[model samples]
Target chain A: MKNPIDNLNKVFDSRIRLGVMSVLLVNEEINFNDLKDLLQLTDGNLASHLSHLEENGFIKVRKGFIGRKTNTTYSITKAGEKAFKDHLAGLENMIKSIK
Target chain B: MRSKEESLDALQDIRKMMERSSRFISLSGWSGISAGICALLGAWFGYGVLARTGGESVSASSRTSQVGLSSMGEIQQLLLIGRLTFAAAAVSAFIFTYIRSKKNAIPMWGLTAKRLLINTMVPMIVGGLVILRMMQTGYYDLVGSCSLVFYGLALVNASKYTLNEIRYLGYAELALGLIDLWQRGYGLLFWALGFGVLHIIYGTMMWWKYERVQSK
Candidate 1:
Protein backbone atom coordinates (compact mmCIF):
# COMPACT_ATOMS: atom_id res chain seq x y z
CA MET A 1 0.00 0.00 0.00
CA LYS A 2 1.16 3.50 -0.75
CA ASN A 3 2.32 5.43 2.31
CA PRO A 4 -0.79 7.15 3.66
CA ILE A 5 1.13 10.34 4.25
CA ASP A 6 1.89 10.39 0.55
CA ASN A 7 -1.81 10.71 -0.12
CA LEU A 8 -2.58 13.06 2.76
CA ASN A 9 -4.85 15.64 1.23
CA LYS A 10 -2.92 18.82 1.54
CA VAL A 11 -6.41 20.24 1.88
CA PHE A 12 -6.11 19.93 5.69
CA ASP A 13 -2.40 20.70 5.66
CA SER A 14 -2.10 23.85 7.80
CA ARG A 15 -0.53 23.78 11.27
CA ILE A 16 -3.81 24.69 12.98
CA ARG A 17 -5.70 21.98 11.14
CA LEU A 18 -3.02 19.44 12.00
CA GLY A 19 -3.31 20.44 15.64
CA VAL A 20 -7.09 20.27 15.57
CA MET A 21 -6.86 16.83 13.99
CA SER A 22 -4.44 15.63 16.65
CA VAL A 23 -6.66 16.80 19.46
CA LEU A 24 -9.82 15.39 17.87
CA LEU A 25 -8.08 12.10 17.26
CA VAL A 26 -7.41 11.75 20.96
CA ASN A 27 -10.76 13.09 22.14
CA GLU A 28 -13.93 11.29 21.04
CA GLU A 29 -15.74 14.42 19.93
CA ILE A 30 -15.13 18.13 20.42
CA ASN A 31 -17.18 21.21 19.74
CA PHE A 32 -16.05 23.84 17.24
CA ASN A 33 -15.29 26.64 19.73
CA ASP A 34 -13.18 24.35 21.93
CA LEU A 35 -10.98 23.61 18.95
CA LYS A 36 -10.49 27.29 18.23
CA ASP A 37 -9.58 28.09 21.84
CA LEU A 38 -7.19 25.18 22.04
CA LEU A 39 -5.54 26.22 18.79
CA GLN A 40 -5.83 29.93 19.68
CA LEU A 41 -7.07 30.80 16.20
CA THR A 42 -9.52 33.51 15.25
CA ASP A 43 -13.11 32.65 14.30
CA GLY A 44 -12.84 33.12 10.56
CA ASN A 45 -9.53 31.25 10.40
CA LEU A 46 -10.91 28.26 12.33
CA ALA A 47 -14.08 28.27 10.25
CA SER A 48 -12.14 28.17 7.05
CA HIS A 49 -9.98 25.28 8.23
CA LEU A 50 -13.01 23.34 9.47
CA SER A 51 -14.71 23.98 6.15
CA HIS A 52 -11.68 22.67 4.28
CA LEU A 53 -11.47 19.52 6.41
CA GLU A 54 -15.21 18.97 6.07
CA GLU A 55 -14.92 19.36 2.30
CA ASN A 56 -12.26 16.62 2.26
CA GLY A 57 -14.63 14.26 4.13
CA PHE A 58 -11.98 13.88 6.80
CA ILE A 59 -14.30 15.24 9.51
CA LYS A 60 -18.03 15.10 10.19
CA VAL A 61 -19.59 18.32 11.40
CA ARG A 62 -23.00 18.39 13.03
CA LYS A 63 -25.12 21.45 13.64
CA GLY A 64 -27.77 21.19 16.32
CA PHE A 65 -29.34 23.07 19.19
CA ILE A 66 -27.53 22.81 22.53
CA GLY A 67 -29.74 24.17 25.34
CA ARG A 68 -31.56 26.79 23.29
CA LYS A 69 -28.26 27.62 21.60
CA THR A 70 -27.13 26.28 18.26
CA ASN A 71 -24.22 23.93 18.81
CA THR A 72 -21.74 22.57 16.28
CA THR A 73 -19.76 19.46 17.12
CA TYR A 74 -17.01 17.86 15.07
CA SER A 75 -15.82 14.29 15.05
CA ILE A 76 -13.21 12.47 13.00
CA THR A 77 -14.67 10.25 10.33
CA LYS A 78 -13.37 6.69 9.95
CA ALA A 79 -11.41 7.92 6.96
CA GLY A 80 -9.94 10.75 8.99
CA GLU A 81 -8.84 8.36 11.74
CA LYS A 82 -7.20 6.02 9.26
CA ALA A 83 -5.56 8.93 7.51
CA PHE A 84 -4.25 10.34 10.79
CA LYS A 85 -2.87 7.03 11.95
CA ASP A 86 -1.27 6.49 8.55
CA HIS A 87 0.05 10.02 8.55
CA LEU A 88 1.75 9.42 11.87
CA ALA A 89 3.20 6.14 10.66
CA GLY A 90 4.45 7.74 7.47
CA LEU A 91 5.95 10.63 9.40
CA GLU A 92 7.71 8.14 11.68
CA ASN A 93 9.03 6.21 8.70
CA MET A 94 10.17 9.40 7.02
CA ILE A 95 11.94 10.49 10.17
CA LYS A 96 13.68 7.11 10.48
CA SER A 97 14.70 7.20 6.83
CA ILE A 98 16.15 10.70 7.21
CA LYS A 99 19.02 9.38 9.31
CA MET B 1 -36.92 40.18 19.04
CA ARG B 2 -33.35 39.60 17.89
CA SER B 3 -33.04 38.44 14.30
CA LYS B 4 -32.26 34.78 13.61
CA GLU B 5 -29.09 35.84 11.84
CA GLU B 6 -27.83 37.68 14.93
CA SER B 7 -28.54 34.68 17.16
CA LEU B 8 -26.73 32.40 14.74
CA ASP B 9 -23.72 34.72 14.67
CA ALA B 10 -23.61 34.88 18.45
CA LEU B 11 -23.81 31.11 18.74
CA GLN B 12 -20.99 30.87 16.22
CA ASP B 13 -18.86 33.17 18.36
CA ILE B 14 -19.55 31.06 21.47
CA ARG B 15 -18.57 27.94 19.59
CA LYS B 16 -15.31 29.57 18.57
CA MET B 17 -14.59 30.48 22.20
CA MET B 18 -15.35 26.93 23.35
CA GLU B 19 -12.93 25.42 20.85
CA ARG B 20 -10.20 27.79 21.91
CA SER B 21 -10.80 26.93 25.55
CA SER B 22 -10.85 23.15 25.05
CA ARG B 23 -7.15 22.66 24.49
CA PHE B 24 -5.46 21.43 27.67
CA ILE B 25 -2.40 23.35 28.78
CA SER B 26 -0.51 21.24 31.30
CA LEU B 27 0.77 22.29 34.70
CA SER B 28 3.91 24.39 34.55
CA GLY B 29 7.30 22.55 34.65
CA TRP B 30 8.10 24.05 38.02
CA SER B 31 4.84 22.58 39.23
CA GLY B 32 6.15 19.10 38.40
CA ILE B 33 9.46 19.79 40.07
CA SER B 34 7.63 21.10 43.09
CA ALA B 35 5.24 18.16 43.25
CA GLY B 36 8.08 15.65 42.88
CA ILE B 37 10.00 17.36 45.60
CA CYS B 38 6.88 17.18 47.73
CA ALA B 39 6.33 13.49 47.03
CA LEU B 40 9.94 12.51 47.71
CA LEU B 41 10.00 14.53 50.88
CA GLY B 42 6.70 13.05 51.90
CA ALA B 43 8.02 9.54 51.20
CA TRP B 44 11.29 10.16 52.98
CA PHE B 45 9.43 11.50 55.98
CA GLY B 46 7.07 8.58 55.80
CA TYR B 47 10.00 6.22 55.71
CA GLY B 48 11.67 7.99 58.62
CA VAL B 49 8.47 7.98 60.63
CA LEU B 50 8.00 4.29 59.98
CA ALA B 51 11.64 3.58 60.80
CA ARG B 52 11.63 5.53 64.05
CA THR B 53 8.34 3.95 65.05
CA GLY B 54 9.95 0.59 64.14
CA GLY B 55 9.00 1.13 60.48
CA GLU B 56 6.04 -0.17 58.46
CA SER B 57 5.73 -3.90 59.13
CA VAL B 58 4.52 -5.48 55.90
CA SER B 59 4.36 -9.24 55.89
CA ALA B 60 6.01 -10.82 52.84
CA SER B 61 2.86 -11.29 50.71
CA SER B 62 -0.26 -10.36 52.58
CA ARG B 63 -3.12 -8.59 50.77
CA THR B 64 -5.05 -7.50 53.87
CA SER B 65 -2.02 -6.87 56.04
CA GLN B 66 -2.35 -4.41 58.85
CA VAL B 67 -0.33 -1.17 58.71
CA GLY B 68 1.51 -0.80 62.05
CA LEU B 69 1.06 2.95 62.55
CA SER B 70 0.49 2.52 66.29
CA SER B 71 4.08 1.50 67.04
CA MET B 72 5.19 5.10 66.72
CA GLY B 73 8.57 4.97 68.43
CA GLU B 74 10.69 5.45 65.27
CA ILE B 75 7.86 6.10 62.83
CA GLN B 76 6.43 9.22 64.45
CA GLN B 77 9.42 11.37 63.61
CA LEU B 78 9.49 10.06 60.04
CA LEU B 79 5.79 10.75 59.63
CA LEU B 80 6.25 14.27 60.90
CA ILE B 81 9.04 14.90 58.44
CA GLY B 82 7.02 13.45 55.57
CA ARG B 83 4.08 15.65 56.40
CA LEU B 84 6.26 18.73 56.51
CA THR B 85 8.00 17.95 53.25
CA PHE B 86 4.79 17.26 51.37
CA ALA B 87 3.26 20.42 52.73
CA ALA B 88 6.30 22.45 51.69
CA ALA B 89 6.26 21.08 48.17
CA ALA B 90 2.55 21.78 47.74
CA VAL B 91 3.06 25.29 49.12
CA SER B 92 5.96 25.86 46.77
CA ALA B 93 3.81 24.92 43.80
CA PHE B 94 1.15 27.35 44.91
CA ILE B 95 3.72 30.08 45.40
CA PHE B 96 5.36 29.40 42.08
CA THR B 97 2.02 29.51 40.31
CA TYR B 98 1.12 32.73 42.08
CA ILE B 99 4.39 34.39 41.12
CA ARG B 100 4.11 33.33 37.50
CA SER B 101 0.59 34.62 37.26
CA LYS B 102 1.53 37.93 38.85
CA LYS B 103 4.40 38.43 36.42
CA ASN B 104 2.23 37.58 33.46
CA ALA B 105 -0.95 39.33 34.66
CA ILE B 106 -2.76 36.02 34.46
CA PRO B 107 -5.66 35.54 36.85
CA MET B 108 -4.45 32.38 38.51
CA TRP B 109 -5.86 32.62 42.00
CA GLY B 110 -9.48 33.63 41.93
CA LEU B 111 -11.43 31.51 39.50
CA THR B 112 -8.84 28.80 39.14
CA ALA B 113 -8.34 28.62 42.86
CA LYS B 114 -12.05 28.49 43.47
CA ARG B 115 -12.48 25.75 40.93
CA LEU B 116 -9.49 23.77 42.15
CA LEU B 117 -10.58 24.10 45.75
CA ILE B 118 -14.04 22.94 44.88
CA ASN B 119 -12.62 20.06 42.90
CA THR B 120 -9.87 19.14 45.38
CA MET B 121 -11.77 19.72 48.57
CA VAL B 122 -15.21 18.21 48.17
CA PRO B 123 -14.10 14.64 47.59
CA MET B 124 -10.89 15.13 49.52
CA ILE B 125 -12.70 16.33 52.62
CA VAL B 126 -15.17 13.53 52.46
CA GLY B 127 -12.38 11.04 51.88
CA GLY B 128 -10.30 12.54 54.66
CA LEU B 129 -13.19 12.17 57.08
CA VAL B 130 -13.74 8.61 56.01
CA ILE B 131 -10.08 7.74 56.41
CA LEU B 132 -10.04 9.32 59.84
CA ARG B 133 -13.04 7.25 60.78
CA MET B 134 -11.34 4.16 59.39
CA MET B 135 -8.15 4.87 61.31
CA GLN B 136 -10.08 5.40 64.50
CA THR B 137 -11.61 2.01 63.95
CA GLY B 138 -8.16 0.41 63.39
CA TYR B 139 -8.58 0.37 59.68
CA TYR B 140 -5.30 2.09 58.87
CA ASP B 141 -5.00 -0.61 56.27
CA LEU B 142 -7.28 1.15 53.81
CA VAL B 143 -6.05 4.74 54.22
CA GLY B 144 -3.51 4.78 51.41
CA SER B 145 -5.85 3.29 48.84
CA CYS B 146 -8.63 5.59 49.97
CA SER B 147 -6.36 8.56 49.43
CA LEU B 148 -5.67 7.49 45.88
CA VAL B 149 -9.30 6.73 45.10
CA PHE B 150 -10.71 9.92 46.59
CA TYR B 151 -8.04 12.08 45.03
CA GLY B 152 -8.91 10.58 41.64
CA LEU B 153 -12.59 11.18 42.27
CA ALA B 154 -11.84 14.81 43.10
CA LEU B 155 -9.92 15.31 39.89
CA VAL B 156 -12.56 13.62 37.74
CA ASN B 157 -15.33 15.57 39.37
CA ALA B 158 -13.62 18.91 39.02
CA SER B 159 -12.16 18.36 35.55
CA LYS B 160 -14.99 20.16 33.85
CA TYR B 161 -14.29 23.65 35.18
CA THR B 162 -10.76 24.19 33.88
CA LEU B 163 -8.14 22.61 31.67
CA ASN B 164 -8.89 19.16 30.28
CA GLU B 165 -5.47 17.91 31.43
CA ILE B 166 -7.02 17.53 34.86
CA ARG B 167 -9.34 14.84 33.53
CA TYR B 168 -6.33 12.77 32.51
CA LEU B 169 -4.84 13.30 35.94
CA GLY B 170 -8.07 12.01 37.37
CA TYR B 171 -7.82 8.86 35.26
CA ALA B 172 -4.23 8.27 36.29
CA GLU B 173 -5.20 8.59 39.93
CA LEU B 174 -8.06 6.19 39.37
CA ALA B 175 -5.56 3.70 37.95
CA LEU B 176 -3.38 4.15 40.98
CA GLY B 177 -6.39 3.56 43.20
CA LEU B 178 -7.17 0.30 41.42
CA ILE B 179 -3.59 -0.75 41.92
CA ASP B 180 -4.11 -0.01 45.60
CA LEU B 181 -7.36 -2.01 45.67
CA TRP B 182 -5.35 -5.16 44.90
CA GLN B 183 -3.54 -4.46 48.20
CA ARG B 184 -0.18 -5.69 46.90
CA GLY B 185 1.48 -3.84 49.80
CA TYR B 186 3.53 -1.52 47.57
CA GLY B 187 2.05 1.50 49.33
CA LEU B 188 5.01 3.87 49.33
CA LEU B 189 6.00 3.10 45.76
CA PHE B 190 2.47 3.64 44.50
CA TRP B 191 2.21 6.92 46.37
CA ALA B 192 5.42 8.12 44.80
CA LEU B 193 4.33 7.07 41.34
CA GLY B 194 0.87 8.57 41.57
CA PHE B 195 1.78 11.82 43.32
CA GLY B 196 5.36 12.31 42.23
CA VAL B 197 6.18 10.69 38.90
CA LEU B 198 2.86 11.55 37.25
CA HIS B 199 3.06 15.23 38.21
CA ILE B 200 6.58 15.54 36.89
CA ILE B 201 5.69 13.86 33.63
CA TYR B 202 2.63 16.02 33.09
CA GLY B 203 4.47 19.15 34.18
CA THR B 204 7.43 18.58 31.89
CA MET B 205 5.16 17.87 28.94
CA MET B 206 3.25 21.08 29.58
CA TRP B 207 6.44 23.07 29.97
CA TRP B 208 7.96 21.75 26.79
CA LYS B 209 4.87 22.12 24.65
CA TYR B 210 3.46 25.45 25.77
CA GLU B 211 5.33 27.53 28.39
CA ARG B 212 8.84 27.00 27.05
CA VAL B 213 7.89 28.01 23.53
CA GLN B 214 5.86 30.98 24.69
CA SER B 215 8.58 32.30 27.03
CA LYS B 216 11.11 31.93 24.21
Candidate 2:
Protein backbone atom coordinates (compact mmCIF):
# COMPACT_ATOMS: atom_id res chain seq x y z
CA MET A 1 0.00 0.00 0.00
CA LYS A 2 1.27 3.49 -0.91
CA ASN A 3 1.65 6.03 1.87
CA PRO A 4 -0.86 8.84 1.50
CA ILE A 5 1.74 11.26 2.85
CA ASP A 6 3.94 10.54 -0.20
CA ASN A 7 1.21 11.92 -2.46
CA LEU A 8 1.44 15.41 -0.97
CA ASN A 9 3.49 17.49 -3.47
CA LYS A 10 6.33 19.29 -1.71
CA VAL A 11 6.16 22.14 -4.26
CA PHE A 12 2.71 23.03 -2.91
CA ASP A 13 3.62 22.45 0.77
CA SER A 14 3.84 26.15 1.54
CA ARG A 15 0.50 27.82 2.22
CA ILE A 16 1.36 30.73 -0.08
CA ARG A 17 2.29 28.37 -2.91
CA LEU A 18 -0.91 26.40 -2.31
CA GLY A 19 -2.84 29.66 -2.41
CA VAL A 20 -1.21 30.64 -5.71
CA MET A 21 -2.00 27.26 -7.25
CA SER A 22 -5.58 27.43 -6.04
CA VAL A 23 -6.02 30.85 -7.69
CA LEU A 24 -4.35 29.88 -10.95
CA LEU A 25 -6.50 26.75 -11.15
CA VAL A 26 -9.68 28.80 -11.40
CA ASN A 27 -8.47 31.85 -13.34
CA GLU A 28 -7.18 31.48 -16.90
CA GLU A 29 -4.48 34.02 -16.20
CA ILE A 30 -3.84 36.36 -13.28
CA ASN A 31 -1.56 39.38 -13.15
CA PHE A 32 1.08 39.74 -10.46
CA ASN A 33 -0.57 42.56 -8.57
CA ASP A 34 -3.89 40.67 -8.38
CA LEU A 35 -2.16 37.59 -6.98
CA LYS A 36 -0.19 39.66 -4.53
CA ASP A 37 -3.31 41.48 -3.40
CA LEU A 38 -5.36 38.29 -3.08
CA LEU A 39 -2.66 36.41 -1.18
CA GLN A 40 -1.70 39.45 0.89
CA LEU A 41 1.96 38.58 0.45
CA THR A 42 4.90 40.92 0.33
CA ASP A 43 6.61 41.51 -3.02
CA GLY A 44 9.72 39.53 -2.10
CA ASN A 45 7.73 36.65 -0.66
CA LEU A 46 5.42 36.36 -3.70
CA ALA A 47 8.33 36.60 -6.13
CA SER A 48 10.22 33.79 -4.39
CA HIS A 49 7.14 31.51 -4.29
CA LEU A 50 6.48 32.18 -7.97
CA SER A 51 10.10 31.37 -8.78
CA HIS A 52 9.81 28.04 -6.95
CA LEU A 53 6.71 27.14 -8.95
CA GLU A 54 8.34 28.27 -12.17
CA GLU A 55 11.43 26.15 -11.51
CA ASN A 56 9.23 23.11 -10.95
CA GLY A 57 7.51 23.70 -14.36
CA PHE A 58 4.17 23.69 -12.52
CA ILE A 59 3.31 27.28 -13.48
CA LYS A 60 4.13 29.41 -16.54
CA VAL A 61 4.94 33.09 -16.42
CA ARG A 62 4.45 35.71 -19.11
CA LYS A 63 6.09 39.12 -18.89
CA GLY A 64 5.04 41.95 -21.20
CA PHE A 65 4.50 45.67 -21.40
CA ILE A 66 1.07 47.24 -20.93
CA GLY A 67 1.09 50.92 -21.93
CA ARG A 68 4.74 51.45 -20.97
CA LYS A 69 4.39 49.49 -17.71
CA THR A 70 5.74 45.96 -17.32
CA ASN A 71 3.01 43.42 -16.58
CA THR A 72 3.64 39.89 -15.29
CA THR A 73 1.00 37.20 -15.46
CA TYR A 74 0.92 33.59 -14.20
CA SER A 75 -1.03 30.49 -15.19
CA ILE A 76 -1.01 26.86 -14.05
CA THR A 77 0.40 24.09 -16.24
CA LYS A 78 -1.17 20.69 -16.93
CA ALA A 79 1.31 19.08 -14.57
CA GLY A 80 0.33 21.55 -11.84
CA GLU A 81 -3.34 20.71 -12.15
CA LYS A 82 -2.67 16.97 -11.97
CA ALA A 83 -0.43 17.41 -8.95
CA PHE A 84 -3.04 19.52 -7.18
CA LYS A 85 -5.75 16.95 -7.76
CA ASP A 86 -3.54 14.14 -6.48
CA HIS A 87 -2.68 16.16 -3.39
CA LEU A 88 -6.36 16.77 -2.71
CA ALA A 89 -7.09 13.05 -3.13
CA GLY A 90 -4.32 12.19 -0.71
CA LEU A 91 -5.70 14.60 1.84
CA GLU A 92 -9.16 13.04 1.53
CA ASN A 93 -7.76 9.54 1.87
CA MET A 94 -5.78 10.50 4.96
CA ILE A 95 -8.90 11.94 6.58
CA LYS A 96 -10.92 8.82 5.73
CA SER A 97 -8.24 6.54 7.21
CA ILE A 98 -8.21 8.60 10.38
CA LYS A 99 -11.99 8.40 10.69
CA MET B 1 3.46 20.23 11.73
CA ARG B 2 0.06 21.57 10.71
CA SER B 3 -3.03 20.17 12.40
CA LYS B 4 -6.04 18.92 10.41
CA GLU B 5 -8.00 22.00 11.35
CA GLU B 6 -5.16 24.22 10.17
CA SER B 7 -5.00 22.39 6.87
CA LEU B 8 -8.75 22.75 6.39
CA ASP B 9 -8.58 26.45 7.20
CA ALA B 10 -5.75 26.89 4.71
CA LEU B 11 -7.82 25.16 2.05
CA GLN B 12 -10.77 27.41 2.76
CA ASP B 13 -8.61 30.50 2.63
CA ILE B 14 -7.15 29.43 -0.70
CA ARG B 15 -10.64 28.90 -2.08
CA LYS B 16 -11.69 32.36 -0.94
CA MET B 17 -8.59 33.97 -2.44
CA MET B 18 -9.21 32.24 -5.77
CA GLU B 19 -12.81 33.43 -5.81
CA ARG B 20 -11.79 36.97 -4.93
CA SER B 21 -9.15 37.07 -7.67
CA SER B 22 -11.57 35.89 -10.35
CA ARG B 23 -14.67 37.86 -9.38
CA PHE B 24 -15.32 41.62 -9.23
CA ILE B 25 -16.57 42.45 -5.73
CA SER B 26 -15.99 46.19 -5.45
CA LEU B 27 -19.49 47.28 -6.30
CA SER B 28 -20.79 49.92 -3.87
CA GLY B 29 -24.33 50.06 -2.48
CA TRP B 30 -24.18 53.85 -2.71
CA SER B 31 -24.33 53.60 -6.49
CA GLY B 32 -27.72 51.91 -6.33
CA ILE B 33 -29.02 54.36 -3.73
CA SER B 34 -27.94 57.41 -5.75
CA ALA B 35 -29.35 55.97 -8.95
CA GLY B 36 -32.64 55.27 -7.18
CA ILE B 37 -32.88 58.83 -5.88
CA CYS B 38 -32.11 60.20 -9.32
CA ALA B 39 -34.76 57.99 -10.88
CA LEU B 40 -37.33 59.19 -8.36
CA LEU B 41 -36.46 62.82 -9.06
CA GLY B 42 -36.62 62.19 -12.79
CA ALA B 43 -40.06 60.62 -12.41
CA TRP B 44 -41.27 63.65 -10.49
CA PHE B 45 -40.01 65.99 -13.21
CA GLY B 46 -41.63 63.81 -15.85
CA TYR B 47 -44.91 63.97 -13.97
CA GLY B 48 -44.71 67.76 -13.92
CA VAL B 49 -44.14 67.94 -17.68
CA LEU B 50 -46.90 65.45 -18.41
CA ALA B 51 -49.42 67.26 -16.20
CA ARG B 52 -48.63 70.66 -17.71
CA THR B 53 -48.93 69.38 -21.28
CA GLY B 54 -51.98 67.23 -20.50
CA GLY B 55 -53.81 70.19 -18.95
CA GLU B 56 -52.87 72.39 -21.90
CA SER B 57 -54.10 69.75 -24.38
CA VAL B 58 -57.50 69.40 -22.61
CA SER B 59 -58.20 73.15 -22.24
CA ALA B 60 -56.95 74.07 -25.73
CA SER B 61 -58.96 71.31 -27.42
CA SER B 62 -62.10 72.41 -25.55
CA ARG B 63 -61.61 76.08 -26.50
CA THR B 64 -60.13 75.99 -30.04
CA SER B 65 -59.88 72.29 -31.00
CA GLN B 66 -56.05 72.61 -31.09
CA VAL B 67 -53.21 72.31 -28.54
CA GLY B 68 -51.36 75.42 -27.26
CA LEU B 69 -47.99 73.62 -27.43
CA SER B 70 -47.58 71.11 -30.26
CA SER B 71 -47.54 67.44 -29.20
CA MET B 72 -44.25 67.04 -31.02
CA GLY B 73 -42.71 69.87 -28.98
CA GLU B 74 -43.90 68.31 -25.71
CA ILE B 75 -42.48 64.93 -26.70
CA GLN B 76 -39.15 66.49 -27.62
CA GLN B 77 -38.96 68.19 -24.24
CA LEU B 78 -39.78 64.98 -22.41
CA LEU B 79 -37.17 63.08 -24.38
CA LEU B 80 -34.56 65.69 -23.54
CA ILE B 81 -35.44 65.44 -19.86
CA GLY B 82 -35.21 61.66 -20.01
CA ARG B 83 -31.76 61.88 -21.58
CA LEU B 84 -30.63 64.33 -18.91
CA THR B 85 -31.94 62.10 -16.13
CA PHE B 86 -30.22 59.05 -17.60
CA ALA B 87 -26.96 60.94 -17.94
CA ALA B 88 -27.10 62.14 -14.34
CA ALA B 89 -27.85 58.68 -12.99
CA ALA B 90 -25.08 57.11 -15.05
CA VAL B 91 -22.51 59.69 -13.91
CA SER B 92 -23.42 59.24 -10.28
CA ALA B 93 -23.23 55.46 -10.55
CA PHE B 94 -19.79 55.70 -12.14
CA ILE B 95 -18.57 58.11 -9.48
CA PHE B 96 -19.75 55.94 -6.61
CA THR B 97 -18.23 52.79 -8.10
CA TYR B 98 -14.93 54.56 -8.69
CA ILE B 99 -14.89 55.84 -5.13
CA ARG B 100 -15.65 52.41 -3.70
CA SER B 101 -12.96 50.70 -5.77
CA LYS B 102 -10.46 53.31 -4.65
CA LYS B 103 -11.46 52.85 -1.04
CA ASN B 104 -11.07 49.11 -1.33
CA ALA B 105 -7.67 49.51 -2.99
CA ILE B 106 -8.92 47.69 -6.05
CA PRO B 107 -8.26 48.76 -9.59
CA MET B 108 -11.38 50.25 -11.15
CA TRP B 109 -10.23 49.49 -14.71
CA GLY B 110 -9.28 45.86 -14.23
CA LEU B 111 -10.12 43.08 -16.69
CA THR B 112 -13.23 41.99 -14.77
CA ALA B 113 -14.47 45.57 -14.49
CA LYS B 114 -13.94 46.07 -18.23
CA ARG B 115 -15.88 42.91 -19.02
CA LEU B 116 -18.72 43.95 -16.69
CA LEU B 117 -18.96 47.39 -18.32
CA ILE B 118 -18.92 45.96 -21.82
CA ASN B 119 -21.59 43.37 -21.07
CA THR B 120 -23.84 45.93 -19.37
CA MET B 121 -23.36 48.62 -22.01
CA VAL B 122 -24.08 46.48 -25.08
CA PRO B 123 -27.79 46.03 -24.30
CA MET B 124 -28.12 49.62 -23.11
CA ILE B 125 -26.59 51.00 -26.30
CA VAL B 126 -28.83 48.87 -28.50
CA GLY B 127 -31.84 49.91 -26.44
CA GLY B 128 -30.94 53.58 -26.70
CA LEU B 129 -30.74 53.35 -30.48
CA VAL B 130 -34.07 51.54 -30.71
CA ILE B 131 -35.75 54.06 -28.39
CA LEU B 132 -34.38 56.98 -30.42
CA ARG B 133 -35.76 55.41 -33.60
CA MET B 134 -39.13 54.87 -31.90
CA MET B 135 -39.19 58.53 -30.84
CA GLN B 136 -38.38 59.62 -34.39
CA THR B 137 -41.35 57.57 -35.64
CA GLY B 138 -43.68 58.95 -32.89
CA TYR B 139 -44.07 55.72 -30.89
CA TYR B 140 -43.69 57.58 -27.58
CA ASP B 141 -46.01 55.33 -25.62
CA LEU B 142 -43.71 52.30 -25.99
CA VAL B 143 -40.55 54.20 -24.92
CA GLY B 144 -40.93 53.60 -21.17
CA SER B 145 -41.51 49.86 -21.51
CA CYS B 146 -38.64 49.45 -23.96
CA SER B 147 -36.19 51.31 -21.70
CA LEU B 148 -37.16 49.22 -18.68
CA VAL B 149 -36.87 45.94 -20.56
CA PHE B 150 -33.54 46.82 -22.13
CA TYR B 151 -32.08 48.10 -18.87
CA GLY B 152 -33.20 44.90 -17.15
CA LEU B 153 -31.56 42.81 -19.84
CA ALA B 154 -28.35 44.78 -19.45
CA LEU B 155 -28.30 44.14 -15.71
CA VAL B 156 -28.95 40.43 -16.18
CA ASN B 157 -26.24 40.14 -18.78
CA ALA B 158 -23.73 41.95 -16.57
CA SER B 159 -24.66 40.11 -13.37
CA LYS B 160 -22.39 37.23 -14.37
CA TYR B 161 -19.41 39.52 -13.92
CA THR B 162 -20.54 41.21 -10.69
CA LEU B 163 -22.68 40.41 -7.65
CA ASN B 164 -25.44 37.89 -8.40
CA GLU B 165 -28.06 39.86 -6.45
CA ILE B 166 -28.29 42.26 -9.38
CA ARG B 167 -30.07 39.54 -11.36
CA TYR B 168 -33.10 39.81 -9.05
CA LEU B 169 -33.28 43.53 -9.73
CA GLY B 170 -33.11 42.78 -13.44
CA TYR B 171 -35.99 40.34 -13.14
CA ALA B 172 -38.06 42.87 -11.24
CA GLU B 173 -37.43 45.51 -13.91
CA LEU B 174 -38.37 43.07 -16.66
CA ALA B 175 -41.63 42.18 -14.91
CA LEU B 176 -42.39 45.87 -14.39
CA GLY B 177 -41.73 46.55 -18.07
CA LEU B 178 -44.22 43.87 -19.09
CA ILE B 179 -46.81 45.25 -16.69
CA ASP B 180 -46.28 48.78 -18.06
CA LEU B 181 -46.74 47.43 -21.58
CA TRP B 182 -50.14 46.05 -20.66
CA GLN B 183 -51.22 49.15 -18.73
CA ARG B 184 -50.14 51.54 -21.55
CA GLY B 185 -50.82 55.03 -20.04
CA TYR B 186 -49.32 54.43 -16.58
CA GLY B 187 -45.72 54.25 -17.85
CA LEU B 188 -44.36 56.88 -15.44
CA LEU B 189 -45.81 55.19 -12.36
CA PHE B 190 -44.35 51.84 -13.30
CA TRP B 191 -41.03 53.42 -14.17
CA ALA B 192 -40.93 55.05 -10.76
CA LEU B 193 -41.69 51.80 -9.01
CA GLY B 194 -39.27 49.77 -11.07
CA PHE B 195 -36.30 52.13 -11.09
CA GLY B 196 -36.92 54.30 -8.04
CA VAL B 197 -38.43 51.98 -5.44
CA LEU B 198 -36.74 48.73 -6.46
CA HIS B 199 -33.27 50.32 -6.55
CA ILE B 200 -33.67 51.83 -3.07
CA ILE B 201 -34.72 48.47 -1.66
CA TYR B 202 -31.89 46.65 -3.40
CA GLY B 203 -29.38 49.25 -2.28
CA THR B 204 -30.54 49.07 1.32
CA MET B 205 -30.28 45.28 1.35
CA MET B 206 -26.83 45.27 -0.18
CA TRP B 207 -25.64 47.94 2.23
CA TRP B 208 -27.01 46.03 5.20
CA LYS B 209 -25.56 42.75 4.04
CA TYR B 210 -22.12 43.88 2.85
CA GLU B 211 -21.24 47.36 4.06
CA ARG B 212 -22.75 47.67 7.56
CA VAL B 213 -20.98 44.62 8.99
CA GLN B 214 -17.67 45.66 7.50
CA SER B 215 -17.84 49.07 9.15
CA LYS B 216 -18.78 47.50 12.47
Question: Candidate 2 clash total?
Answer: 0
- The residue-by-residue lDDT of candidate 2 on A1-99, one tens digit each, is 776677778787788998999889988898898788777789999999999999988899999989999999999999888998887776666665555
Worst 10 residues of 2 chain A by lDDT: A90-99
Per-residue accuracy of model 1 over B2-45 as CA lDDT, tens digit each:
23343344334434434333432233567767887688767756
- iRMSD in angstroms, per model: 14.3, 2.6
Give the runs in model 2 whose Cα sits over 4 Å from its true position: A1-7, A32-47, A62-73, A88-99, B55-69
Error of 2 at B176 (Å): 1.6
Report lDDT (Cα) of residue A17, candidate 2.
92
**Tens digits of per-residue lDDT for model 2, B59-171:** 11122223345655666666677778888888898898888788777777776786788899999999999988976665666778888999999989988888889999999
Each candidate's DockQ? 0.04, 0.44
Q: Report the number of the highest-DockQ candidate.
A: 2
Error of 2 at B213 (Å): 1.4
- Model 1 chain B scores worst on lDDT over the 10 consecutive residues at B55-64
